[model samples]
Target: MFFTNPLDNKLRKWGKAKQELPASVSAMKEKVLASVKPKAEPLPKTKNRTPYWFVLSGALAALVLFIGQYTLRQINTPVADSGFGIASQEQMALSSKYEEENLASDMVTPNVTPSDLGIQYGEATGLGGRSYEDSMVEKVSNFISTGQDRNGAISDAREFLKYDYSATIKTRKVEQISSRVQTIVRGHGGRVDNMYVQEKHGYVYFVVPKSSLEAFKNEIKGLVNVRFYTESVRAQNLLPEKVIIEKSTETAKESLASLEGELAILTKEHNTRISDLQKQLNGVVASINRLRNEVTTSTVRQEEIKRDISRLSAVQQKLQRQITDENQNYNSQKFYLDDRIKNAKSEISNLAEQDQNLQDNVETVQGSVEVEWVSIFEIIKLYVPYYWAWVLSFCAIALAVNYFSKRRTIEAL
Candidate 1:
């Protein structure tokens, strides 16, 4: 009863081992502390040393640049808003004045020399000479070669000098006048721009160079009856407009070049996209072809079905017509049979009534006949004695006569 358990003895040994472990841990911590060394402190950072003047100078320069750019933009804004960029208000006013002066001067004819008109002519320049065309060509060449200022001066000088004349020639001989005018225009080194002819009138529009205009008018004056005549001079200042057009043309050329570059890039991208799209399109086309084939087969089948339906419909219609006809025939036969049966029934009823009446008449006739037969027998009995009496009287008379005859015969004998 006093024996100790084995588990209790083991628990006591475990408690003793745990009590010895703390002394071993303290000795290990003392050895680690004896081996360790102390660490040094980190160094401090230095402050920035740049001068304030450098930053101030940089800010001032940026401010000055921004102000200059803003001022420049403010100055250019109004000029840009005006459509004519380089032309000033003074220049525009001068051009308008020149236009007005030219318009006024165009109404009156002015004495003009070949040099004043900016044309060059030789001594042999005439309506009948080939040098006239040469002189016109020279004038055009000189006008082109001269600068804008000189051209403007020349244009002002020629403003009232250039003449355009139109005349209505009322002549019955239109063909002859037309031929003569054409010859005159050609002889003056001019060309016919337009010509129209009618039965009663003819019209001719021709252009003669400034050098030949007077000669052309002189030649055509007396050829036909001049009904209506008009002369107009072209007097316009084109220098300012020409400068603007030239500038605009230059800008347009630059823009066109830039646009062409962009277009080239776009075209390249478009070609790439198109190639990809073309591959997709090829697939789509293959699909479409397959669909088309399916559609064609389906269409064929649909057509066959439609034909079948149409045939069935036609057969159905024919059967319906046949049924209708049969119904009509059956109805007709039924009506006829019904009418016959009704008539037979009616005749049978009438015959039965007639038979009943005949039976009644026979019975009445039999009764009357029996009564008449008894009456007739009674009458015959009453008549029979008279008939016998008459017969006996005649027999007696015949006996007397036979006796007399016998007596007479005996006497004779």
Candidate 2:
């Protein structure tokens, strides 16, 4: 093809511009230029370089977000047995058993409160207080309240305590018997609880401390010729009922303690203020006594009044009889005299009624000196005749005789 001058000039201008390209341009591009020159635009790079801090910040932000998301999802998630499962997790769970939370102990684990559990947890197990029963009653109560049934235990205890101890020795004086008993008891570390020495009969009662009961009994067998031994000691686990009753009694004692305090205050006041009142009362009492002296014996004030009324009636009748028998001017005089006697007796009777009421008031107040006693009676063995007593005695005697005969008869022979 023929090249025009203008086209040749344009080509030379483009070649100079390409010649300005970097020397690193390859021989390959030169060969491509020889084959067919192509027109194409090259992409440009930023004149300013990117900063290291921006790239580092973007990477750090992405890492932090990934960690936060992982942590959020982990919360409230069920425990698993992965690398981060419960086995590897640094956590422990508390026991959730209701018994462990409530019972507070493993032994005698209470299943329910006493109200729901019946008598075991009832108010009967409450604290104790004082009582008005005598010492004997108090001791028995204490023994039973731990767990023993009341009536049954007391009956059992009484049966065990009953020992018809009847032994007659050659000792002339009561002192010798007492001395011998003391020596035997003390030697075995036992002590006598009670002894009675009277004009008619002497008796001794002692307790061998429970720990020594068996030992003491055994020693006694070797020491004495046990004529009649009917004492028993039994172990008993008292029921809760006794303890409940005892505790109730203790509460009663607490109440009584408050009452006794009030009584003490009253007594003090009586000593101070009521003492003066007592003087007035004593004067009233003295007047009452003097009036009572005016009355007859074998009668209360009411009875006295009746007796005097009868006597007055009898005397008046006799006087009337005498006057009627005389039957003279005495009949006119009798009317005046009989009327006077009737009026005097009527006044005395009215006075007696007043004195009776006063005596009653005094008697009503007299209970301050009176004490209350629970009536206890000896149960007479009425069903058993003297023959039974003799049998019991003869049995005891025969045993003693047989033992003595075997032991002593040989010596005598």
Candidate 3:
């Protein structure tokens, strides 16, 4: 028999095998080579070129157009026109008119003019209604100094008023006293030009005629308790002083006019500012309304979102409950299945053990049966030779018994 070495045969087979590239690899190599090779066709070239001057001209034109448009826009821009100037002018006119009316209404015409006070183009008088010359002569005669003359005394006396009286009365019943004083002043053809009445005290400013002043004082003295009183009498002309006062009054009136004009201007400015502020307030109100609407919309959306969230939360809670129930059921089923599996495994193990035991018993019984069969075969083989001998003996005994029986039967017959 030929025995070839396996290692040598394998080496020979490996050496005889042909080394060749796959068809797909060869085809891919050919494709790569074809792609790497340069093509024979020539690339096309443009014949025309745009001039730099044309590009530059287009850019310049665009810039000019942009500048022109910008200039147009600047020229077309509207100048804002505000009504504040006009409104302020109108308000100033109104304020000036109102101030003039108020000034006219508030000004009180004087009842006692400079002439009534013996201060204007009049002869000076004494407290007793004496003429200025007579009063001066009497005063010079009574109390003239050594160097002073009658004319000098008279001039000195004429520079001051002859009499000016003011008094304050105190009383427990101010209201009643004030009323009586008013009545007496009125009855005496005098006027209570100014009066202040309070719970504890009263002030009565009586403007009595020069002739009735003494009578008015006496009447008031009878009506109320007099806390203090004074009377003054001095010669006065007051003409030059009145002239200075009139000049000062004129200056004050001029200042008041200037102040009124300035006040009108200020009021006009204030009204203009108020108008602007009113416009701003109206815009603010509009914005507030818009914001309020937005807030209302947001509130509605918020409510809707809240309801949606609530519904989603409820759904989530329900789903969570279902998941919990499912998890519980799954756990219960898992436990039941686990127990069933364990029981099945235990039963299978027990069955396997029983089956092994049965197999062992069957093997033991088969071995015993085989041993018994072999012993039975041996016994049968051992009895096989004696079986014929025993049969022969049985046949001899049967023949002898048959002969004897036949002989006996014959004898009996």
Q: TM-scores for all candidates?
A: 0.22, 0.19, 0.20
User: Residue by residue across 113-163, what tens digits does model 1's lDDT show?
Assistant: 666653454434443235644466565555445534433444444222223
Q: Which residue pairs show backbone clashes in model 2?
A: 129-250, 147-238, 147-239, 148-238, 148-239
Cα lDDT of model 2 by residue, 1-413, tens digit:
43556887888988998776556679868877899857677768669766899889999999999998787445424232132212112221221122233323421232333344333432364422244353333444444353234334444442212111212221224454545555556665655666665432355565444444446556544433332111222232222223344445555455545555654554464355535544554554555455556745655766865665566556555555544444443444455545554554555455555545533332221100000111112012222335457778999999999999898878888
Error of 1 at 155 (Å): 13
Candidate order by lDDT, decreasing, is: 1, 3, 2
Best by lDDT: 1
> lDDT per prediction?
0.52, 0.45, 0.50
TM-score-superior candidate, 2 or 3: 3
Candidate 2's displacement at residue 58, Å, is 99
TM-score of 2: 0.19
